[model samples]
Target: MLHGQSNAWAIDYDNVYNDNNLPEDAHWVRTIGAMHVYNRPAMYPEAENTNWYVASGKAPDIRGGIQLVGNGMVGVLGLNIGLNLVASQNVPIAIINGAGGGGAIASYQKNDSGLNAAYGRLQHRLEASGLKLHIKAFIWNQGEGNAGDAVSDYKNALYQLYKNLSSDYTFEKFYLVQTPPGCSASSGHQTVREAQRQFAAEHLAVKIITRHGFPENPLFDGNYFLSDACHYHAHGYEMLAEWISNMAKYDFYNGTVDYQAPQLVRVIRESGKSLSIEFDKPIAVQPDLKVDGIVYSVKDQLFAINSKKIISISELKVDSKNNKILRITFKGKRLTKGAVITYVLGDTYPDTKEPYRGPWLVDADTGVGAVGFIKTID
Candidate 1:
């Protein structure tokens, strides 16, 4: 995972990972904060299966499924976990923190010239990498600068920024995180929140995650803040990180539909070795074979898999003792050498209003990751 840390956000990645007892796969790197303008410190990390690219003050070059963390407002650890999820899922993510505190949009900067410049530089570097990099999301968490100026064209700029960024990037998935609840001076904490909410409503791809209900421990308790009444203390940072983690984990898109099934399913086994698979009227997507959870996807939705290792179930014969079990005979070849043939079955939901059904099938050594079949036909 990668993150950015500056005056507003202090992230010690090693500390967070170590404290959490995370596995070694959770490798991460950090970017220096607001004053850092060069790319030297950011791009030097050794690339691994998952890479987190974070920016505190400016945007950095990122490709593949790498996540870019910016916006000085996101505390070090909060950004860390978000990066971790993106890395694990191998998806691209980008975070843009408006200049912090009293800044336009209620961040630190009265102007966003730094952010604008950073955006331009990041775009150029990404293009230079020869990778088809696309920006999919944006996270905003600033509003201190425009406290009273909420009445100004602040709303227009916010929307304009999204429009302009999206013009270059294709993905509409955007998230607006409200500024922390407490600001010492006159800040547009509430007004900006309203404006952000309004922006999200008007835009189909945009949504808002509220910080209005966040605890005000740092603002009220001097102990929770550093000498400066603006920044948070260690404990406060942890709380903020936890809040961001929750936001990252929230799934606005859960399109679970009622599954309907047909009758007369056929089973095709295509593995060189035979695998033992049982059929259930209402079978779990991926049954537990060993320990680790395996994720399978027919389309884009996440489904369970038995495991990564392929188990051998040889000389399998289909016997239809009951009229309900319909089995098909097929020639067996080799499955993937390392991978086993997991069960492929029709999905049946017991609670559906309509008759639920599907056919389960499997294929082996026909080809690499052979497509086996158990299709349901009415």
Candidate 2:
């Protein structure tokens, strides 16, 4: 099951998979904005498209599964999820999506007093399929519309959603995709990201999917990663689906793989002149940040605040002894306990055409970026 706002619905040049050539009994549905369900059977050999394909066959297409009515925004990730599953495990998968683009978290909630349209749509789709009450998992990617709400309020609402969904449905796991850093109009975008981080830490079997990979050039005219600042291109959606499939492989299928993205395990102000930003796992320095011949300094996105005096960061690199610690260097100066450190500042660009702008330090092999954070030096 895939749910949430625009990213879930998709805004891309094209879908990751062409739905016309999917495997047997692999079907999907979409209830983004309105009901557009698809029940097409594009039966082909399991090995046909090893990397990408959509869903098809053996599902009742009650109400014509996934018809793009209005602008034909066709990049629902359910298709890629099904395709990857079938390709990797040869198991036909079914995906049910109930998402609305530009919707508030409150809107997706279960309102008992009145007609809950989102809830109704999902229930109807579940009933339409044979799996009336049970789903394998719920994959959620939301939080652009809740920009105005306080962090606490938004989190409370999300908690309400979690409660309602768990009570109302029978699903194994709930995967929450951390919101992409884009909504330039407000700082709420970062707030949403932070909220997601905290929420995932507190919950169990609840994984936070990092929708990473931003443009190498922060000032690029256009990005291949996203259709716009907020929405995803096919590349963006593909990255997201990859992680989802990765978790499934490692957790459920017992596949030997490292699917987790690197996050800040601890940040140590190791003396005055330097800070050791340690990750949960071994990490490597992304050697060149220069994009299109422009020198994009990694430290520009990083901030180290010393109240007594201003200390400019001289260098940021992987620690010599430890692969996990990001060694932040400065001239010989003492960083006090109350000094603050923040990453990816100035993330939003409201006035201009570009909306989301930030920097990242990525995983060595996978290129999965580290989570953006703002924390006081301790």
Task: Compare the candidates by TM-score and give the number of the best one.
Answer: 2
Cα-based lDDT for every prediction: 0.34, 0.59
Give the runs in model 1 whose Cα sits over 4 Å from its true position.
1-23, 28-78, 83-102, 105-116, 128-133, 215-225, 234-378
Clashes of 1: 35
Which model scores highest in lDDT?
2
lDDT of 1: 0.34
TM-score of each: 0.43, 0.77
| Superposed model 2: Cα runs more than 4 Å off | 15-74, 113-116, 127-134, 214-222, 225-227, 290-293, 302-311, 331-334, 348-359
Candidate 2: RMSD to truth: 7.7
Q: Per-residue lDDT for 237-354 in model 1, tens only?
A: 5454444444444432232321111112333333433323333222222111211133222211111122222222222243345432323222353433333222221111222211
Residue 133 C-alpha lDDT in model 1: 41
Tens digits of lDDT, candidate 2, 1-378: 878876776643442244455444444332222333221122222111122223321222122334332211224465567667667886656666665554678767775522235665565555545564667778888887766455578778888888988877777778888776675545445567667766776788577667655444233243534534665556556667777887778777777865566777777878878888888766765544433344444664435363122336677788778888888888776777776665554344323445443446767656666665556676
